[model samples]
Target: MSDTIQPPFSILFVDDDQMSRHHFARAVSDDYRVHLAQGADEAMVLLKELGPEIAVLVTDFRMPGRDGGHLLREVAQAYPQIVRILVTAYADKDMLLQTFNTGDLFRIIEKPLRMDSVREVLKQAVARYAERETRQQRLLAMDETLAFLAHELNTPLAAISLFARSVENDVAQEYDPQRQREIGAAATSMLNNAQYCLTLISSFWATVHKSGGQQPASGSGVREVRAARLLATLLDSYPFAGLQREWIDVDVHGDFVVHAMPNCVALVLSSLMSNALRALDGCPAPSLCIEVISEPEPEIRLRDNGPGIAPEVKARLLLDPVTTHAGQGGHGMGMIFCNRIMQSFGGGLRIESTLGEGTTVTMRFPGSRGRIRDADGEQASVTRTV
Candidate 1:
């Protein structure tokens, strides 16, 4: 079996002077993948193309057109993961101070650069990059594990709540002995499932915490959930009432099944749907369409005819918690939470929007392998049985 390996750390050296760029690249070529850019414009292009792979950026401060500080600021906003270093021949104290204050500049190299000093700075930059990456990966893994745990615990709790309600209803009314027995059996099953899930969660945390905080394997408590039924449950219980509820539409392409913990999928959909509803608050003739496509992949597309996201908001939408509707109590963590859940499922979430037009949020899940009956007694499509 082939093992997955990370590519070598890369550095992008940007300088208007050809000799400086060439010398820098040559010095680090042996230890890193060195990329050369002549100016800030070229550096921007390279940054776009190799943002994720390039770990460090070294740019000359006194370049024509946009300066190194400009490039560093851009990288800080768009690709904060990239470590930035500034090189300058003339050491202007005020300029250096401003650069440090405004940009994510890691270090500054003085004029007539010493090869040894350059090498040391490059080594430190690589070390810092690796440290940040490791910390981020650990946090992300922990976030995923926690989301899975919450979903696992929530699903069984929901089942218990549902079964408890059934028992309450049966006892409240004049019930047949057969109906009472059936309700009792369902309650027993719910208790058993809850107990099993609680045990699994306990063991999951113990293993994860003991194993140096590594991510726990997925599908530990995964169960098949029907797409159509899931959507129906969400829509029926949606906070919207009366005519407002009529604005939402759900289209399921045949019977589709998603092999995941039911609550995890529901949590993702709920977050997306809630955002859509909020976006449509003041729109004229607002409508939300949810389409579930089974073949090719199990994907859900939630499209809304509402005011699209602003450019500034769209740029950092999933990167951090940001809210466009701060006045209306928007926490801005909904999409981030949803993104984490999808990633934990080995899936992804995508959002596309045109200002003044609308926004479409696509959620792709692991494809189904076979067929299974949903809670509504309807068959759903899947690729295989887990």
Candidate 2:
């Protein structure tokens, strides 16, 4: 039944024997775009022409001109993506070791291939190809994410550093003893806190990439605190602290505490803030207001006054990576990170927008409060929204 399912990828069979090529093609022809190559030269031509579309390569190890391992190595170097498989008559130890070292071969199928074994190997090849593609995309995503963080945080980081240094310089030069000491201490505190915050951001950037865009299993539980208060504290630490930022204008309409990872909550809130700010860009006196309503179900509505998202943008807001401003770069990993965090905490993200009006992003944790549970019921707690 799975074989009958639509194949989303293409594959190539590169073997000199006519029967072998026919057999491989016939086996996988029902699914996938199967191409056949009679020799290494023909395989090279096919690869160059359809490299991007092809997802896997099946080649024989003992061909007349070029052996399977050599041909596959060349293909791996040239294409890197097409999953390689070596089909040979015998499991030659030396050649097998060489193939393994080459590092792109997906599997080794013995010659006079059994139909079932060949099917299984091809199936695995498809899965491996899918995984490889996913990994590549995630890596590209991490790169984009880092660029975004650098772009968005650069200005604030510079300002914080500059202002803190200026405060110190001014304090040291002041003539009055009491005034000088007071200013010096205050400047020192501010500078220290700024440094700490910068360190945290740097650590977060490293963690995001290190995670491969996956959320860590930090689990769920509040840190002996209330939900709204926790959210407020998170907003307080954001770069726009004390600015005319809209995220600060928030009201908790529910009386509840959440037993969830505080860092996860913070990450989600940060993502919401970032989305709000992006949506509010270019608007006249942009403002964002968050309202937490928990009676029917725990939900935080993040509304903004900036121009609403386009229909297309709204449709793909959660599906695709957020578009970074030209040269204002980012790895587009923030939202995905937030989404993963939410899912890990038994929650999901929702967005509604009206172009030229405004947009709102809502986060809802579906699990019930009082007896919050994860698979094994690891003592999860829910802070009811008041």
Candidate 3:
């Protein structure tokens, strides 16, 4: 007992019965720091008051005002960082009928409470919370490091443009006016691209990392951006080498706001472009048309006139890594990453292709009424969570 280390975060116990709250808190207070809430409403108040200090939520199913099931669902959306547990008289039937989403509730406790079993569950729940916090810290560190590198690179890139301009001026009349203009434009484009990438990295970092005296949105990294605005930025800053830019056409008929990490969106586009370029390498004509469509749903579609994906390869593309360009350093994680980002927004991705025709990839986004909040800043309604 003396050797047992207290958890970094506290446990919250919510029950309608006064005697029950005291008994439960009294039993576990030695090993774990516990907060008592008489009902669901009180628990919510405590959550806002304590914030990040509370990690595990244990509430009785039959509570006054609001039931524990509702509390769990609300917490899962608002503060996904908190691990939730339900205390119910009838565990099996109540859990199955009430909470079909296993993702929300962590564990179900049966009454009358056995102190030993309850203690064990609390211990495991604390362990889970500790692991989640550790992972978040690691991810935040990596993201901040990348942001720092991007910020540091911006200065050197601007200096390079200035140096190039000076070198060109020193050798004036060696090139015609039109040639000089072209050289200046190219240098400016290079600097602009770096600056754009830095902006995206900074934006993503700010969204994911807690900043600007803003309360943390646990387990989410996405922010809202208009599809048209994001696409323009992506295309303009994209390092389109050689004649690749000429092969691409973008048409924005309708725009929709999508929730996602901007840099991740750019990465997804880069992956798709790389795939299309390789597929159309030896073809007589290659074209990639990107369109923002508003119809049955808000969507972004990418159509490429290249050798279409084979039936076998297409079938396995979303499920697993199916690639023909293994020799060229391709691991086939592009579509996988794209699928994850789409799903995080409560949207989906579809790939359609035919032999000798082309491939069309559609990115379906959550409409105005719906937004799925996945871990890494997907926004939703719950205001109280760690």
Candidate 4:
């Protein structure tokens, strides 16, 4: 519910049925600020007017004149940041999968729209939007800080080095004759190195800060990454100590593709690895499984045999990240950032854990392949043998 008394962000619900739209709004208005659009045409007008305020777009699959699929595709082209969700009673996997991949659907809700399920999905959607916004702000701040390092930091350093070099020369010369000669030579060498560094900084300032250009996001151009190849590279280069490498088992039913920045994928894997390793620290015979599946859209799953997370802790962490191991220097930002990254990829991360049993984290990527899973429970995997 955004942990706020007032509704946090706007959710646009588009449906041709008046009863359905009204019921959806009435049920969700307590948790979210709901906007009603009777069809794609009206939805477009509202989006144009209140686009910045809206965080999610939940439209029924069957709407008059332009339909939800058309609306979603148009929105994907224009307002890509808004999370897209589809509500459908259409049991056809082929149609759903096609719309899923094409329209960049963040999630699909089955018809008979249970209010409980709707609320939960809306909460997650809101969280995803918030996390994306937070990440953008951080990126902007990081860019500015980098620019400061390149442009604003050099002048003071130049002055300091100039004066310091002169002072060092004078001190070495005036102090004692023999030692002073040795010291002066050393000081001169240091100054030469400092001058070289300054030259490099000046070059960087000129090249990067010209006209105050903004730096694009890291891996902004990345998409359609091969899961098998990427996993191979990550496992090869990932730092594993002693038997840690052997402890991991990769079950490749078949290679599949994922769409996201390569760096983001690496970052997600690294975080899961770190967390799993920490959880296994005091355990006996630890193991982790990396499952690469081709069906129901390409997916990479990581299952770890470690102390499973408590439900309460998991709940709190999902809502607001706080380190479980703060004493051990954990900042607790890994999973939420991973969640945001997965959302940014047009998929979502699902975590299932039992107290005594190990945890399974599934990373779902958006694509049309094999049989589609149920929107709620685990999907039947139709594996392609390599």
Candidate that would win on TM-score = 2
Misplaced by over 4 Å in model 3 are: 1-224, 371-386
Residue-by-residue lDDT tens digits, candidate 2, 25-132: 777687767888888899999888988778888888888887877888898789988888888887679879978798466787786889888878888988888877
Candidate 4 TM-score, true structure as reference: 0.44
**Ten consecutive residues with minimal summed lDDT in candidate 3?**
377-386
lDDT of 1 by residue, 1-386 (tens): 22433346789989999998788777667677889999999988988888888999988899899998898898899999889998888768999999998996899988788989988998899889988876675566456646645654554566677777777766768768888788877876576556645554555555456655643334656345688888887676544533557788888886577655454576578667767877897787999999988766667899999999988888788778897755433456666767776665556677889899999998867554334333353554422211
Candidate with better TM-score, 1 vs 2: 2
Quickly count the clashes in candidate 3: 6
TM-scores for all candidates: the values are 0.52, 0.56, 0.47, 0.44
TM-score of 1: 0.52
Query: Which prediction has the highest lDDT against the true structure?
Result: 1
Better of 1 and 3 by TM-score: 1
**How accurate locally is residue 107 in candidate 4, as Cα lDDT from 0 to 100?**
95
Candidate 3, residue 12: how far the Cα is off, in Å:
12
Residue pairs with backbone overlap in model 4: none
Give the per-residue lDDT digits (tens) of candidate 3, residues 1-386.
44677765898999999989999988998898899998878888999998699989998888878888888887787789998888888747746466747437778778899999998998898888887875664454344334333433443355556656666676656778887787776676566546545655565565456443232344557455777887887777555656778888889888876544445455555556556766877778989999987644577888998989999999988789777765433556557656655554456567999989999987766666554333344555322111
Q: Per-residue lDDT for 165 in model 4?
A: 62
Number of backbone collisions per candidate:
9, 24, 6, 0
